[model samples]
Target: MTKLKTDRREVPVDEPLDAEVVSFRAAFDQRSPIDQIVREGARRMLQSAIDAEVDDFIARHAHRTDEQGRRLVVRNGHLPEREILTGAGRIPVTQGRVRDNDPDHSRRVTFAPTLRDAGRYRT
Candidate 1:
């Protein structure tokens, strides 16, 4: 019998490495821990900014009822919900309902999340 030598240059047979590579890339690049934290912070900051702007706008335009049973200047027919910072903390709020035929349109109905329960609500 003659002795034969086998080549050792062939690749090993196993699952393709491409899938593992792809999964690693996705896990590291797409949803990294740092990325998630930064995203959450940015979202909170944006929400705060929006809430402040809405409150300021409402304060500037809103009017109070008068002694003569007439408002000096009605801004909005519908009382808008405002994101308010109270002694307790920031809160998501909805204003009381107003007459349907009221003339003022400045009072906008705003929807904002409270600091305590901000992240729970999603669009």
Candidate 2:
């Protein structure tokens, strides 16, 4: 699959819960079509949310930079794709990555610490 460029400005506000009957093409996977749609949508949602969070981090640190004048925190594209097991199913996702120009910072510069292996915890 190709890398998708999502516009961070396109985050939706509040939408009505859509439970209407929808059609989905059957595939080898046990997940129903709706499940697949949900999985993909969830993946995109998660990616977008993280992207926004990263943007906030970058903004907060924008005033700080290395000696070369490069931003302290910058968007580093994304990490490799990984599967996140959810109640819906195992959905493949590629999370956004950030480059920490300042190595002295205490934070690890990742969603990992905030997300903290979501699959292992039962929330």
Candidate 3:
């Protein structure tokens, strides 16, 4: 029986080693624990910013109410989750949904994240 060095491990000569395993070892970049932490932090920060934007929008429309005093602008729910490719990696985000219940279509207000407003993503 004979042994050969594959990367840093010893493999028996009888067993075949994958060519990809040896070739891609230096090219492939494995995400470290720190990278995972950074990705999670970015995700949380983005989510917080989006939620704050929605809150501010609702506050601004607080004056607009119906005859029964119900607010015209309110949070309906979250939008479909989408993944954004960022420097940190792919981050899944769910933006808040704002529905303007105003009877006049001309005076309707649509809420969108500042990131989208920056022209980074299409609404």
Candidate 4:
């Protein structure tokens, strides 16, 4: 590789060169590896906990069926995708959905997971 020579009038030797000029972000962009690992761990843990909560909630009414042999609780699909901001970082998650089969068609229920103020899930 060849280095280009700069004109003396354009850039004085007393002043800093172009290569020496570093922006604040570029100079301080080094991230901590341990912090990244910890944040990833936290994200996975939160996701797992939410999944377990949904599973437990479904298990409560999954087995029983009505007189017509329709399961009491059935998995529909997923709710909506949303992200939650945490101390670690922003975590993305999609909660599971369930339909509660009732004898009366008008009284059927659908489970909607909500994030409580305590940083826990409420089904």
Candidate 5:
């Protein structure tokens, strides 16, 4: 007796389900696997860069508290009233108590910058 060879057309290859493979292909085509990977990587890189910048800023301006447990960062001066201009309009500024100052009378009082100041101290 001779061994018989199976027809190539009757043999099944190692392939995924047609529906599953079609869905996968569609998803990849919609977003492109390469593009999705690149976008995720870029997003992570940008987030890391932003985190590093924030960390550096915080390290440079670490806050300290006084015996009274007040924020060491200057917030206001001894001035009674001051004029401040904002996007809306000009507004009156009320000064906060002086926390620390030079022994010498330099007449320059540093005020704590607020969100309004955009991170710039007022003098």
Candidate 6:
């Protein structure tokens, strides 16, 4: 026979509970079909808005061109996908990446979505 080691700790009333001991109420699998549908819709809408923002940025910089007469500020590709926590749930989104091909690094301009700057959506 082997001896068993059992350790116990005392908790204070003012102390907060550990994360492992707390249960989440908005678990993904536990959510209803309607909730899932709403989340999908929200994700699509958010993506569309971001795309529009990118388009607007490119339009505003249309005058900026290189020696070859090609637009300097244009969409290169998309950034890595990330999940943003929203009111509906965790929504996956990808932001458009803009490249400024200006030879002068000091005059280069970058694009940033307004939504990302807002504190409401925390990734």
| TM-scores for every predicted model | 0.38, 0.56, 0.73, 0.60, 0.32, 0.72
* Cα-based lDDT at residue 18, candidate 2: 44
Question: Residue 56 of candidate 6: its Cα lDDT?
Answer: 97
Per-residue C-alpha lDDT of model 2 across residues 16-95, encoded as one tens digit per residue: 43444222322333667787789889878766765676677778778877788887778889777767677767666665
lDDT-based ranking = 6, 3, 4, 2, 1, 5
List candidate 6 stretches off by more than 4 Å. 1-28, 119-123
Q: Rate the local accuracy (lDDT) of all candidates.
A: 0.49, 0.66, 0.83, 0.69, 0.47, 0.85
lDDT of 3 by residue, 1-123 (tens): 899867877679988768888778855577788898999998898778788988999999999999999999999999888776678877777888999999999999988678654323323
lDDT of 5: 0.47
Model 6 per-residue lDDT tens digits across residues 1-123: 999988978789999877655655336348788988998999999889889999999999999998889999999999888777788877888889999999999999989789776425444
How are the candidates ranked when ordered by TM-score, highest leading? 3, 6, 4, 2, 1, 5
After best superposition, candidate 5 residue 99: deviation in angstroms?
Answer: 18
Which model is ahead, 1 or 4, in terms of lDDT?
4
Best by lDDT: 6
User: lDDT per residue, candidate 4, 1-123, as tens digits?
Assistant: 999987765666687656645565576565589877877887778778778777877787666688877778877787776666777656666767777867787767566555534454323
Q: Count the backbone clashes (under 3 Å) in each candidate.
A: 1, 0, 0, 0, 2, 0
Candidate 4 global TM-score: 0.60
**Total residue pair clashes for candidate 5:** 2
Report the C-alpha lDDT of model 5 over 34-94, residue by residue, as the tens digit.
Answer: 7667656654554354345444443444454456765444433344544444332233444
Candidate 4 global Cα RMSD: 11.8
Give the number of the best model, judged by TM-score.
3
Model 2 regions more than 4 Å off: 1-29, 103-113, 120-123
Residue 49 displacement in candidate 5 (angstroms): 0.6
The count of backbone overlaps in candidate 6 is 0
